[model samples]
Target: MEEIIDQNEHVGIVADDLTSAADGAGAFLTYGYQPLVRRQRQASVGAPVVAVDTGSRLMEEADAMRATGQAIASLAGCRHLYKTIDSTLRGHIRAEIAAAFKASGRPRLVIAPAFPTAGRTTVDGIQLLHGVPVAQTAYGHDPVHPARASLIADLIAPDLGRMATVPVSATDSDIGKHIAGASIIVVDAHSQILLNRRIAEITKHGPALWVGSPGMAEALAAVVGQSPDRQTFTPPNAPRHILVLVGSANHLSHAQYEALAATGASVADRAEGIAKTASVACIHAPRARTADPSKVLCALVDEADIALSRQWYDAIVATGGETMSALMERLSIHTFTLVKELEPGFPLGCARLSNGRPILLAMKAGGFGSVMTLCNATNAILQMGRKST
Candidate 1:
């Protein structure tokens, strides 16, 4: 990857094995990411390893890795972890593994930087570290494979300066379990070469499957192959929501409200209109306000949380099946749909067309009163792994 996206000062390298020479890149500089293979070669045998197990699949460090590797690597200081509840014997197993990860003290959050399966190895790290929920990435199967994870991250990052950003858009093959009108991606966009290499790094699991918005996702499908065969699932990054969906009666919990504020989505009434515009001074639980006019609705939707995310959502929409469907259709992307029978909480469902493009839909069903607030967040950690092509 570093060679693929090399700049004079910056090079982006994603290697399958955990060695410095693994990718044909030269030795690590004082300030570059290195995989473990390189580290083992350079480090003195008696030197303390001082490994920082991120509780993940563990990519080789920029310094530790070369183009070669016995293992992959990961970044450091990511905030998030997992805690496993197992039987007594399993607990003992966990404790021993934990010892190698951290010192005597319990680590705060067990951080999992979103890997292929989130890896059992990461789970064991949590037992060694403090109590952190297994952080998971939301991206699903990508033909681009190993490099796609970081590629998606780079797209969503505030700065697009790490490497050359080439936007590869391709049409998906129209022969799989995808929505109608959706096109799969071909060309270098869905780097099968990279995916295959990364899979070798994780385990022998075949690959994951990501099915959602027909447009971009189809691109991935085209590369992974049109085969109906399945294995592990490729997660999808929760769409960076630009608008906030709020019900008149639905309220935002203190924590939920804070999360909304943190992401910077907007607040709207069930009627799908904005209550405040211009500058939002405070992010408190807004009084349950109903939508009165469509203009108000449009204005509110326009100003919702899209700005809060690492993206400016095309639009911040208020809630309603009609509006949502309309938006999904117009955008030609999948919109989340909530089943009418599903209970309140977080609901998940997808709408697919016949092989062309799959529409990602989010809908909430059942006695959903018009008094709740809706906001879009990271859903998990910084494991966002997709962007509309």
Candidate 2:
């Protein structure tokens, strides 16, 4: 509380005892996800809760932070203690809430479920997890948590909507090998940097590449999608798709052309012209392989196929968990901000968003994974890698 006050920001002190102190401030006074100031003012009264736990162990760590917060909130008091949603950090929050519940032996623990703050988590179930006194569900996803809606309306003002596809060559193809008759047509305005990266990669493909202003269809002409959804899909499809090849003794034999040929997609027959015009919203489309999951898979395959391919790829193979982690570690940062811990290094692998908690990834594959299907792993790499470029 002091730190928050010192920082000169909204100080939200949770606890039945300190309700008054946080009066003008945001208060979980009612004890739930959104027992905001307005709702607190409108409501006549309510009970209290003692403890709460978020769902799932999640990599076994989400509960840590929650438990910690609960511990702190327990110290506050006024009449009620709002237990936040269940989260991996639930244990920590519970410890704090437990303290308050133990003191009051009946503080109202409310269910406040909503998308967690960018840096926070939500523990949907509060009363059951913690033996607190009373429970009040304020908000939820599908059911529309009333307490939650109240605050969001009071704060944000909600608006929502919407996908798109970039056609390669506009021409139709008669050949059976080609997925589409046209060339690659990428979304021009796509994440500019990523777009530029893909453009640069296509350029590297040399004469095999045919320019189409910018988009997937054009890029695919020069390359092939490695994932199931890249080109021909069953039914549902994604607009942005990329393809990469890493066969032939894992690049030792370096049969680049053969690798490109491995995919049966053919050139547009009687190909005339592809529309160069592009639209916005390309920002989210596939761009570049900043992490290179394919490289990781290639290394893994070559490492195992030594007798089959020998020294051809002895130097550039990575057929192991460490290699895969190294590949996705970069992009995974967006998913789990605290992901520097996952950077590939000796001794300790890296830290990643396991189930939900932040746990350091260790090498020497510890637990036995049942379906360690290499195909699924390959497809996973292809899916993530194609998005890179």
Q: Tens digits of per-residue lDDT for model 2 on 341-378? A: 11111011122332342322212121112222222222
What lDDT tens digits, residue by residue, belong to model 1 across residues 1-389?
A: 21111112121122221111111121111112221112222221110011111212232333222322211122111111112111111111122223222321222211122122112111211211122222223212311112221222211222211211112231233212222222111112223333323222211222211111111111222332322322222223344333334322233333343445555544333323333342221222234444443443343333333333333332232233223333333444331222111122222223333444332233331113222333332232112224322
For candidate 1, give the lDDT.
0.24
The TM-scores, one per candidate, come to 0.24, 0.17
lDDT of each: 0.24, 0.23
Error of 1 at 255 (Å): 8.0
**Number of the top candidate by lDDT?**
1
Top-TM-score structure, candidate number? 1
Model 1 misplacement above 4 A? 1-243, 247-249, 252-255, 262-296, 302-323, 329-345, 348-377, 381-389
